[model samples]
Target: MTAPKAWSYSALSTYVSVCTLKYFFRYVANLEPERSFSRMYFGLAIHAGLEAAYRAWKPDAPAPVGVAKKVFMDDLTIRLEDPMIEFKKGETPEGLLTEGMAVLDVWAKEARYEEIISTESEFTVPLVHPGTGEIFERGLKGWFDLVVKDPDTGEPVVVDFKTTARRFSGDKLEADLQIRVYSYAIRQLYGLDRANLRLDVLVRNKKPVFQRLEVSQDSEGDARLFELVRAAGRGVEAGVFWPNDGSIWCGGCPFTQACARWHDNPDALRSHSEK
Candidate 1:
């Protein structure tokens, strides 16, 4: 198994707890996904719209609702041209465009930040072992959706944008691995002892909803994130891969066929490990 040059939250989260075989197929074997889901592309388009709005935003001005909707339309138009997207039942490009616009409408009204420090900020930090405090060669890399100063506290707030079918529960926000990783990154990059992480969620409903959930970084969560990253990295280096069958994600996994082949002849795994 070839070691990934760098690790991202998505990579570590999937490898450590989600599905090992899926990680191997995508990262180690470098296999193209058999199908791409429409929801993934829809989220990408919405993210682009949010980024555009934030980029054009001015302090103490009306939110760029029109700019956001226009960008979402243009972005989704281009994305829809890609024929690989497998739209879910009852989902069409036209319907999604309308739904995306409605989401932006709600998001614009609630857009209030004291200062927009950065948007889509790229970060790379050394992966240090939680137990030994040993820094690994490969770094952890990710992009911050938005970074701003809190109007009330005058503290740095790291924001992540999400398009969810339902509002995230407080427990879900607290337990999210992505949030923990971002919190850890903020400590490393901004030199802050504690991180304020917020999730700006656009809920998909008949009438869309926008909600912001805040989570403070704790030592335990940060330590858990570091340890998970360390374990995932070591597992990859050791060529450890397994399938998590009988799970919800198993049905729609793009690597299902490849995983089936792997089960029949495990020796095939050797070919992927060869340098």
Candidate 2:
């Protein structure tokens, strides 16, 4: 007979925190239309599904697995079956699955069996800036999903995988701020030498897209990113959340109703609500 799976408490807490932060970031940063349960659940589903695929590929990697599982189980009890089969069919790999599973395992046991996985691993919460001492008090903390050194230059490349419901038009300038913020944090934590980063967007029903962004140690782009961070900080302090209308993001936004109400009119909000 097979033994029952154990729980990991610390991992579960981190998962809840991360999921909460993601929702907070979108709401506070005005990155999305508004915050709603559907948006949260959808985001969690995509994140979990992709992560499960990664874990199925590399079960030994604790960090990714722990993170992935936490997000999946916390937001949804959905499990990934035949992750290997999903990957072979040209689906995005789930490098974040085990982390997600670890999170769920803890939560389930804690609530049901009263068991938890205890460990000393430091789980960095992405609430404040890891560098520059800037406090995104209202904005959620951000972190890179993956980082690898360039084979030749040994420069670290920060990579983040995003799963969206729609397809990205392969436009770098119009990319999400989360990716750019992540690049900024990576530079600050690892120094300018490791600021090179790339953003990978995996559309659930479309082709995968890649965007390479270089954060030079002394480049104007880096300066801009820092400025944006400062701007975000100020917005957080001022309680400002300017929704981007006509961004093609509102259609899938869960907070559309609230955003429309706040904007004072449906027409005003619709101007930028194209998806």
lDDT of 1: 0.83
Query: After best superposition, candidate 1 residue 171: deviation in angstroms?
Result: 1.0
Candidate 1 lDDT by residue in tens digits, 1-275 = 65677788888877876898899888888899887877778888899999988889888888888888888899888988887778889999999999998899899888773588899999999867667788777778899999998888777899999998787787777778888788888878877878999888999989999988898985567566666776787888778888898877786688878887887887677666665
Candidate 1 ranges with C-alpha deviation above 4 Å:
129-132
Please give the CA lDDT of all the candidate structures.
0.83, 0.40
Index of the highest-TM-score prediction: 1
Kindly state the number of residue pairs that clash in model 1.
1
What is the C-alpha RMSD, rounded to one decimal, of candidate 1? 1.8
TM-score of each: 0.93, 0.45
lDDT of 1 at 62: 83
